[model samples]
Target chain A: MSLLGGGIFKGMAVTLRNFVGSYFYKDRLTTNDYSWRPSDKLPQHAGEYPKEEGEQLRDTTTVTNYSRNFPMLLHDGSEPMDTIRCVACQICERECPPQCIYIEKSTEKKENAGGKPQFYPAKFDIDVSVCMSCQICVEVCPFDAIVMNSQFELSTPDRFGGLLLRRDDLLKSNDYYHNIHPEEAAARDKRIAEEKAAKEAKKKAAAEAARKKAEEKAKADAEASEGTPDIQEDAE
Target chain B: MSLELIRDILVATVPLLLIFPTLFAFTTWLERKALARIQNRIGPNKVGVPLTRYGGRFSLFGLGQPMADGIKMLFKENIVPRDADRLFHLLAPILALIPAMLVLCFLPIDFPWINNIQDSVKAFMLDGAVIFFFAITGLNTLAVFMAGWASRNKYSLLGGMRAIAQMVSYEIPLVLSAVIVVMMVGSLNAAEIANAQAGWNWFIFTPWGLAAFIIFFIAALAETNRSPFDLPEAESEIIAGYFTEYSGFKFALFFLGEYIAMFAISGLAVTLFLGGGAGPGVAALPWLSVIWFLVKIFALIAVMIWLRGTLPRLRVDQLMGFAWKFLLPLSILNIFIAGSALHLLAGGRLAGLDEKQPILRQLMEGANPLVVAGLWIGALLILYVAANGLNQLSRAKVRPREYKYAE
Candidate 1:
């Protein structure tokens, strides 16, 4: 028979070794102090926490490419509102399971990133408190306008007002999107580019077919006139 | 009381207030740091003597964390439930603190502050100091129950009932184990017990004391609601157990009471088994005993913290069964074995030795050295064999768990 309580003593020895090893071996520690991290690697929201000079960064803990919390509106250019891709189709708002997404389509059309005049969302608000982070909004978005953000540090003291994200807060740069989820943003950008290329090819193919059809009709009409003239001459 | 007696009382009591609370604060910091290191994470290094925020000039490894915690606790709102019994709710924490603090008087630690050693010894000495210590410590359970019952929350009530059940079950084994030492000492006085194990003649050197000490330590862990025996304060299941409703300074008071109780209990264990303040070089400098005593107490506390990190909480049934089935019976058997061993040792030159004298002293007084050696070996063999037999008997039905996932 095995010694009783031997497992406990063994476990104690392991923990003791770990406790001592952690002090000497830096690699033993899984997480280091984030404040010691360089300012560039600091997150965008780090300014809210206590940081040194030029350390206006967010808490970058637990943030990774695969991590997703809530939906954010993506804009291509520096100007978030002007270059916004959302046409206010209300697809995500309608498809939202919790009905947490609120959108108001602008009456007047505005020039989007594609230089096409489109109805932008006049008011976009998402109640993050109600959001289950199912990414359904991301899935249903047609214009590639909405995507999941990796910033999970969304705890707020104000339930209604604080958690309810406004249009400005929802608007994030494509570069910021790339930084948060590089592979996803890259794949999405490639897909949108491929769709634009396919649409151009389809339009060119249709224009070539229309021109060829017009030429054939003209040729047939000319041939018919010549045949009628030849019959008249034969009658004379 | 006369002026000299009042001075003497203040002299005896004031240092306990000063030393233990300070030690309590330091122990909190130490526990966090040690546990963090054990788990391979840096703990509480943020709050320190920060000369400049983000400067990293002189971060003193979060030494200021305990001070900061105290300040935060002081500033927090003392929230009380609306439907709660307000009077008992208020009194529960106070009651917890009193028994914990009161039992500190019974440990036979001799501080150097007292110029006259006789008066100081008198303060710690009582005819039934060990029994009185146990009686007062039992009141800690009442405070726990009071807090649990007063809150009127279902979790709190559940926690209180658990505290009652666990404490009651463990107290038997706890007392029975200590009974070995008291039987060996032939007196219930705390001072006599400490003095009995003078020098390296610690009761733990004996086979029965070893068994009893181990049993006592386990029971003490349960008694203090420490981890592995921390079913009452099962954080995930019952929230924070009885103290779920308590917050602010009242919660802090509970925390303080728990640590002080830890110190008090560890102190008792040292007195009973480890030879109270009986380290080497005590003869050269008398003040070293106080330091040695504190060191031994800290050692036990350190092990408690380590075990907390190492062991998972025992299931409620296992906790009760282990106490009743294993520790209780073994401790009961341990007392008998210890008594018979003492009788066996009291032969040859020790035959005429005074009965009131400690068994160790009587043995040391020119008993056959070979007989003493044989007795040690024989007693150890007997206890070990009996313990193994009991283990096999108790665990007869507890079949080894069969895993389906992998071989």
Candidate 2:
């Protein structure tokens, strides 16, 4: 009889604990809709969210200033978000399994008088409905223009039109991108600036050398036209 | 003819009937979620949208998934093996499924009779419900054999043999445990047994009652071919076992039957050990009894899911050894103890005890605490030793022998 009582009590205790505990944690764990809220802070990368107070301080102040080559932590500070290393290459569009990504190359316009076209992506769109979230687009993107976001709560009505995000919807400012993926963005910006500076320096050195060579040639021509062939006779 | 009475019956049954299927659907979701958690991953979060009528935006993927799975099974091309017995092949799934659903008819989810029922006819009868439940469950083995033999496949044959072996081994313990309850209550009716256990006197609170409950639970697990004992359809050893040759909706019928069987057996456990629909002051408010009953059933199902997630499947011979050697003997002992207690109570040797006092009260009054604790500890130790011994013995028997070269 005692055996039976103990067993029943033990079982009851387990369930009672669970029920009571759930009630106590209701405020933190409840999935009710009224609790959800949006914020202005940039979403943290996949695994790089701050943990300790010290880590949070480092993440907010120091980590955000690091260059693009540095790994960006995502959601739990466990997954690395390697962004900004994109070369603007269109390989991701071609390899997308769901064909959700659309990219339009910037083309120079002959009709309009203009400087050399730097970048032109007129209409970039991604249909989130069609996207399988396989991360294939992220994998194949040469310029790393597209990335997998940890923002999973994308519920909407009307499957066809509501889920299709245009360029405006997907676009983030450079500062916002850096804040989310600090280390990677900083590294990329530094690399781009270094490459541009190196190209300019090379061009300037070549032009200076050419100018000196032309001046020397002009002096020789003028001296030849002057008819100064008696230099050796005067020395004798 | 009264509208209120009709509404009451409809309200009662609609919930009872819906409870099974709704739990079945949720069980599918829960199983996936639990398995994913065990394996360190997320599962089915993308299905049906959250906080919406149609479900959240991403929820369509999750919601449509089950529908898509069903349609795929429905449209799949059915293939019949050339050498298979066609008649039995067609009949087996139906046979398996029908009994699974039929047993629910005897299951009393609410009051025995609604207020509007003519006094001549009882809306529900709990009398002989135990025997009826056992009889239907007994037929499951036959369906399993039919499926195995009809397929004409070696794996199917092996699976069928295992099922028969398991069912035979567990059936003795299952029935013996129930006999303990019957002897105490002096009635075969589930509702009567429940009524006998009013207030805090649920059968699970006594010496024999505890033993019987454990024995019954373990036996039921084996009977349902659930995890640890689910050697028949061991995916690693025999892919899908008896139903390997079955395809399309025919195969789905078997799947559905298994889950329904699981629900039925869990319901039976609730009826036997947990006092069925008898809760505090529940006789007056019978409706609350059903709710209490369902809460217990769902809790049991959750435990089943947890067990499935946590444990690996047991080997075939290990399963048989556990049932025949351990559960059978323990359950038999439990019956004897219950019989002795009943005899003592009936003879009036124990004072201040009503013969009709629930099992819980009898245990609280009559049993020696020290002896009870010793017996329980001893039983647990014995079970542990027996399991390890059998595991070793099986290993030794199956060990590969090295061949000696002739001199």
Candidate 3:
């Protein structure tokens, strides 16, 4: 019923189309020439990549929104320590599958971004060599403090010192996060805002309920005092 | 041995020796570029002219990559196993190169200098060049086996055995398919076959030749170890097969020999099917035949590269079955069809027409156009149905693949 060797022609056709299409269609050729300098898409928020060959981040990337590698701590202001979101609860450290995260809670509390006294990590280190890039730490963090970073050019000569990323290296601005992962960062921010609004509403309701209870208690006391006076009158 | 005889030989042969190796180098670059393009990736575009690496300046589209590769291969350490057969290991690559080089002489390229050379002195212009080509080409198998045996490694031995099994199996169909051309031309000489197809009278225009060409091309792919049939050197299975133990210039020689073999086979294909050196502008400029021949050879090589990029290497059993059960039967049927077509369409020509005249010309000149057309159509139909029937018969009964470990 079928033509013999027809499949070969069909396969050859597909390859021929691919061979021809690649020259005309830009998207077909996805590889970026890494040897070339800064693609315009880069330096959006991270600044110019290091000029040195060894320290240079990949100047061009086809990294999409969901592409993630390693975990980084998020902050909002001029100083990372002052505006950091992590309260050093060690929740991520406990939940990490690979046990790559290391955190030491500060002896004293400090004022965080929310104006709440929170314990910051005195020592936060992520052994990138050990980290599996599973994003479990991202999932476990309750404070929205840690998120996956797509910056994969983390190679270093000194395996111990270089791969064990410190607090300073892990800390990245929220703006940089939004720049790299716009949709996800925006959604996270909106979720946090909604939770804050709900908390404020809950606090207001609790205060109103407390005020109503106090008013009822005071009225009951006044009525009892009035009933006692009436009893005295009756006695006289 | 005399000076004039030596001169005449050099005139005929030296260009072949020089031109093909250079083409081999360029073909390496071409294959990489083509395969990369097929995969939608840039290949070898970084290594351009030397001293251009500073500040990431100047890339000449990676043309220098082949030269760089050649230099690296030359300088690399020639490591041999202590237990290896040192003599054969050293000789295997040399042995591989010799036959591939020898077969190049058999191609009917019509090189320009041949006009001045004496007919007796021209070794390539042989009475049985076609047969000689097949005979010499089979020697590559021996070289492959030698390389494998000499290496004293299990993987190399496996590769060598696979190569022998594959090449021997495929060569049957390869030669069988060509027998149709030889039959039609009434000559085993490469030059005669090429001459028979002059002025767009390619034998492939006939239904039988079409079938034989396809069969020949497939067998050629297996014979040369081109992919989809490259089980002998299946890197995943045998770690580069027979060449696993070879390194440095010895390895380079093997690589060179393989590419030259590819070129030689492609040239033969052009001679047999595509009307060897028969192209436009050849009538006016005789030298253009050589160029056209090389161009056609490159076209086939390009297809080989494209197929290599597209198809996965075949399993050994599947490879053998396809060659033996599928291709062998099909090629045999093709020969039968060609004999019948010749009898039906050009019966008188086969018996009494001048043998020197092209078969296509004789058939056309002697017969009515409508009768010829009807016979050609009928022949094509019969060949197609027979091929389809063969395809159905040879297909494996298994519907889907079952992995033993995964399940």
Candidate 4:
């Protein structure tokens, strides 16, 4: 009832609890073991990090997917032509608030299967000094060409030379994207697959119509040879 | 010097030289590790490792961190300010360190099994060690002032002033609390005081002794310039305090003095309250005294570290007010109460009781243990309530803060 020295005792109890709890209650301690051999908690790497909240803080470090630092270009990973997702539409280049993005559209004529001259980034640059990592560029990119990278360790001695990242430095494979953000990568993969399937279906329909027309024409010619009437009346 | 005298000198100095550095090193390690644990992190597990080939699996832990720190300090440049008083600046740390080391002389850490060499078991003992300890430790104020003033910096000067103020103010409560123990024990010798508290006869068990221990402990925190009372070296406010200009081994010496003082004061507290080197096995195997002494010292240090981790630094004004108005009064009253209670418990005469009997035993024999304990506990509770009431009455009549909420 007197409350005399009670606060001091309460504080001491709290600290003592934490000190003991750190050993047993894995979540109380935020220290990574940093061992050489792989552990059950972290099998892949010596220092296993937590990717989500309320997980064990002991023997672990946390990595947040949404810690947007620098921008990176995503290149699709399948076969002969590893496609650059960026159509070089220059939408991100236009929408970037800091004007850090400098994109030069490819001048060379390179046609795809559809006979459309596909544009690629000939010289893409992002001056990280000016870039605020607002993620507006990634958001505005219609083709999902750009995504924010979580690699924050971009320190360099040569400030001006090191910070101005080029297309080569910005490029990351789709596999890497999946490793960092699996859900986002899965959705993007499904969307791309659907688009490809729809294109294939349209092509097949057009080919079928053309083949049928040729067969009809051949039949009409045969009829003419046999002194039978006209093919113009077949429209109805 | 005679050969016998020289041997005697070596016996005293040789062991101490080895022991003090080792104590300082381990204390630092203990502090870092304990603080880290309290703050929910791993600390200093990498420095002592011999090989990194196997990384964490096979490598040694960071136990050699203090050695690394010492080596680093040795190589660093000793910087002296351009306009500083160079003589005092150099001498201050040495001055500060001497008293800390001197206090260890009075402490009887081990009670030996061999009867012939019993006197030599301790480093040395003085007739009035408690008085000597207070006198020597008081000189630390002068050393701090010298360091601060010699640095020729405003922040250093300010820190030095605060150090003196806090030390002087807290000395009253520190001395008063110990005085109560002295009153009960009726001796000035450190060894005698410790002997008074035999197995389980520790002062901490009794109500008045517990009150005195708490007061002494708080005062000790201030005396050693530990956190919650570390205003003199508050890094956030003033950079490095009085030793701002010091570098290299000079700064390390200042640091060494601080830790040694912490051990010294805690050792004194152990002697006063926790029954120094007195344990169950100590009677049969007297060598256990060393182990018991170390265990108690480290336990006290751990508590200090826990406090450091838990409590925020007290503001300068709050620190001063708490010492002067709160701790000072409480300690003085505790002394009075301890004296009167002892008298009452002894049937109104302190002389007729059996001297060998512990106060707890005496009280239990005089009355029932339960009744005596209950009465003492009740008295403490009443004191607490009265103290709280007094504090309220002292505050200026601004309607209590709770009234504002009502309005």
The parts of candidate 2 lying over 4 Å away from their true place are: A1-236, B1-19, B29-84, B112-128, B152-154, B339-407
Question: Which residue pairs clash in candidate 1?
Answer: A43-A58, A45-A58, A46-A57, A46-A58
DockQ values, each candidate:
0.62, 0.04, 0.48, 0.57
lDDT of 2: 0.66
Clashes of each: 4, 30, 0, 2
lDDT by residue (B1-407, candidate 2, tens digit) is: 68866666665456546667666666677677655544444456554744456454446426544544566889998888999999998888888877877676556566544545543233236578889889988899999989999999999989988999999889889999988888777677766676766676777876677778888887888888887678778778898788889999888778878888888888888887887877766767768887888778777777776566556687777787777776777777666666665554445544455655554356546666675676556555554454445445544454436998998
- lDDT (Cα, tens digit) per residue for candidate 4, span B65-133: 777788899999999999999999999999989899888877777634223333543444676899999
| Residue-level lDDT tens digits of model 4 in A1-236 | 43655677898999999999988888999677653333344233324543443333421311454556788998765431246777688989899999999999888756532345678788889999999999999888877789877665566788999999999888887887777666676887788778778877777766666556755775777665866553443321
Q: State the lDDT of candidate 1 residue by residue for B80-114, as single tens digits.
A: 99999999999999999999999998998877776
Better of 1 and 2 by lDDT: 1
What lDDT is reached at residue A50 by model 4? 30
Specify the poorest-scoring 10-residue window by lDDT in model 4 chain A. A53-62
Candidate 1 lDDT, A70-173, residue by residue in tens = 88899999888899999999999899999999999999999988888999999999999999999999988889999988666666779899999999999998
RMSD of 3: 6.4
**TM-score, one value per model:** 0.81, 0.59, 0.81, 0.81
Better of 1 and 4 by lDDT: 1
